[model samples]
Target: MGYWSSVLLVFLGSCSYGVLSTFVKLAYQAGFLPGEVSGSQMFFAMVFMWGVALLFSRRKVRGKQWLTLAGTGLATGLTGILYYQSLQYVPASIAIVLLFQFTWIGVIIESFIERRRPGVEKVAALVLLATGTLLAGGVLAGEFGSLHPVGILFGLLSAVTYALFIIFSGRVGHEISPYTRSAVMLTGSVLITFIVYPPSFLLNGALTEGLLVYALPLALFGGVIPTLFFTLGVPHVGGGLATILSAAELPMAVFMSSVVLHEKVSLLQWLGVVIILVGIAVPELSHKHRTAAVRDRG
Candidate 1:
């Protein structure tokens, strides 16, 4: 695929993720706890992805690759748990903002692993992202005052776990096909969620009528489609660009909430969104330019 085509696919996949939160909220309002919704979604996602994999690829799935997928799934599942728990104590907007700190986390982790620091552009992007998050989350005005300390802690932990997922997924990209990778990750998530909250499925009677209806769409959109896309696109996009594209989810969430949930968006939040976009875009554009320049020189 062409570079721009890959970039567009990544962008679309990330935007899909961005709009997913509202569906999650709808599921929650329907009386589904985070564990139940997330667990069920992954379970169904695995089934769907496996079906696709079986249809398309005759390649044998390897044992070590399965292990790597499990590890990735575990990381992905833990991040979900942390994020969902954080949502219980904080606003979705704030929780999302905290989760997106993964961009900086990715940069720092890459720096340590690669034994080289990020360039000036990356540093500036990180700073802008931090500032934009503060503004977008309304933390600057102490809006997070309502959030529990434990929730905040989990939010940060989610970012760390999520960053780890990005790193590990990138490393394992060469070893497995995207479909196989997605299936394994989903299977891992299923195991963890079931083990951690075994009773979630058993408590179906406790859920509202509304939640049952919501889960079907939520699982399809939030869990299945996006995971398939991420699995397919991330390997092509690279983790850093993937992270930046995924940040698009925040603005999408905000826009969706405003339209669907009728939530009010403040001026500062809009400004923050613009700033965050610029922060993410700058690095991507710079990288593309540098790549083109190198090609020209050669």
Candidate 2:
């Protein structure tokens, strides 16, 4: 696949994740607890992914590869668990801003792994992304109320785990089929989720009691689409660029909140969304221009 195509996949994957907060909020309003909401989503996602893997994945995964992908899923599962927990204490706006910290965290992780400093384009993009997140998250709009310390902790930890996920999702189990890889990794995620929040939703009939509606969408957007897309795209795009592309999620989340949740998005927030889109484009546009220039010289 072309590099641009891979970048598009990652973009779509991150956007899919951006839609999850709306559905999660809906589930909460419907009276489902956080454990129930997260647990059910992972449960359904694990089952569906394994089904797809059985039908489509042909490559046999080695034991070590299985272990590695499963371990990586720890980050995946914790990201949701922690971020959701954070929302309980802080407003969604604050929680999202906290989660958006993954933008820089991801860049830092890539720098450490690659043993090099970030290029000027990435640094500039991070600045734009940070500025945009503050605006879009309404932090500068005076959205702050009484901020809970525990919520802030969960939100920041979620950023660290999410950054780890972006970095490792591209690095591990390269030879395994994306289908099989997503399944194994999701299995690991489900285990962590279940351990953290027991599977009481199963016996409590939450699935039959309206949680299934929310769970299905959550599983589709949060679990399946992002997992498979990241598995397919992140390796080709590399973690740094993929991290920048993943900023697409924040603007998307803002759009979803306004449209679905009927939240009032101020004009400044819209400006922030525009800035974020530009930030997402910076590295890609820079690379494309450089490539065209090199070709002209040749």
Candidate 3:
């Protein structure tokens, strides 16, 4: 039950991300730049998180903890910046495949940092994730028309940053309340984004309908909710499984795009979506079998 709860939390976080891209697209159509989108999202999310932390959380955050969570935010915040930049030149399909490399990158990072080898179970799950991402990205459907070298770099950078964020958020400041920790992390993100976009949001009609209409929802789904969910849940499951479970975002993104955005999804893409679901389940089932085996031995 505990494990399942963790899975539920990670999946919820992933789904929040799943819906975020559509909002980003809408914001762009409304004439917001990537900087504005990323900037406003972090600004609003940071403010909301701080309010939550102050009102509901009674715990006082230490200076060191602040620094650590801020570092984690640097990674998360950079993920948004870099991923958005990647989409500028590369096809979304190719960029997505590069970004999803975090699935295995997280696994590998955990392996090295923890000084442990990945078992066969973990390796198998990674294969499923990679294959599913390939299908989901329409790699075989000829959707990956062309690539940009810089966009590829940015996409890969996003994957590395995201993997680091996952690994650190799970490992750091476990004693702090999620609200407080998330606030601190978001503060770091706010700082990073402000540095990138500058203070233009103050007087540049940031509160205009175009930005406000989608910006608020983007911050909630893309920033606040996912941070809280991941901060609360990832430690319980470990980063590897949590990352795999996050594969939910790809399929959910495809489904939501089809339904809400009225985008056309190819049959092969739906097959990829099903494969992603299978990928998510493989780790859980493998863990269940191993647990049962240990129980029987005992």
Candidate 4:
């Protein structure tokens, strides 16, 4: 039941991210640049985090742990920046496919940590996941006129950094309260975002306009809630299963676009969604078989 509860936590976190892109698109339509979008989210997220930390995360962050958590948070910032920047040179379809590579990357990292190669079941699940991501992202149907080397580099970098962040989040600072750790991490994200896109524009009325237009939704859906859910849940689930569960975001996004944006989802896309969900369930559903295989190997 505890494991299933962890799965539910990851599912909820991934669901928040599923609807995040729509809010981001709304912000973009309101004329916010990527930097502005990222920064405003971070800035507002910091405020929300601070309030949450004060209320529940009363524990003070110490020396190295602060830096460690902050650094992991900064990696989250980079993941957003790199992914968004990649879209300038590549289609969103390709970029989405690239970001989803973190699924297998997480598996590899976990294999090393556990000092055992993943069984065939895990590998099959990853292949199914990648296939599903491609279909769900519309990469199978999108035209690619050109894939810029720089954009591809950024995309791959984002995937690696994202994988590392999940691994780090699950493994580090086990003693800290989730609220406090996530708040500290968000502060790190805010600093990194500010350094890249200075908030001086806010003094010139950008803040009020952005806030009025899109801050609350973006901060809540994209920033505060997802971070809180992932931080609170991943440690219990471990990085591998949590990462697999994160695939829930793509399918949820497809559903959201269809319902809210009135976008059409292709038959192939629906199929992909089903496959991804099945992939997420594979490990848990096949637990006995996997354990038997492990025992046989030993």
Q: For every model shown, what is its TM-score relative to the native structure?
A: 0.91, 0.97, 0.94, 0.88
Candidates' RMSD to native: 2.2, 1.1, 1.8, 3.4
Give lDDT tens digits, candidate 4, residues 202-278.
77687777544676777787778878888878888788877787878778777777776566678887898899998
Candidate 1 C-alpha lDDT tens digits along 17-82:
666567777667666787777776666667787887777766776888778778888887787778
- Spell out the clash pairs found in candidate 3: none
Choose 2 or 4, whichever is better by TM-score: 2
What are the per-residue Cα lDDT tens digits for candidate 2 across 116-218? 9999999999999998988897878677656888998999999899889988999999888899999999999999999999999889888899999999999
Better of 1 and 4 by TM-score: 1
In model 4, what lDDT does residue 14 have? 79
Instruction: Tell me how candidate 4 scores on lDDT.
Output: 0.78
- Estimate every model's Cα lDDT from 0 to 1: 0.74, 0.90, 0.83, 0.78
Quote the lDDT for 240 in model 1.
65
lDDT of 3 by residue, 65-176 (tens): 9899999999999998998788676644455567778888898999998899977877888887878887878778766555667988998999999889888889998999
Model 4, C-alpha of 244: deviation from truth (Å):
0.8
In model 2, what are the clashing residue pairs, if there are any?
A: none
Question: So what's the TM-score on candidate 3?
Answer: 0.94
lDDT of 3: 0.83
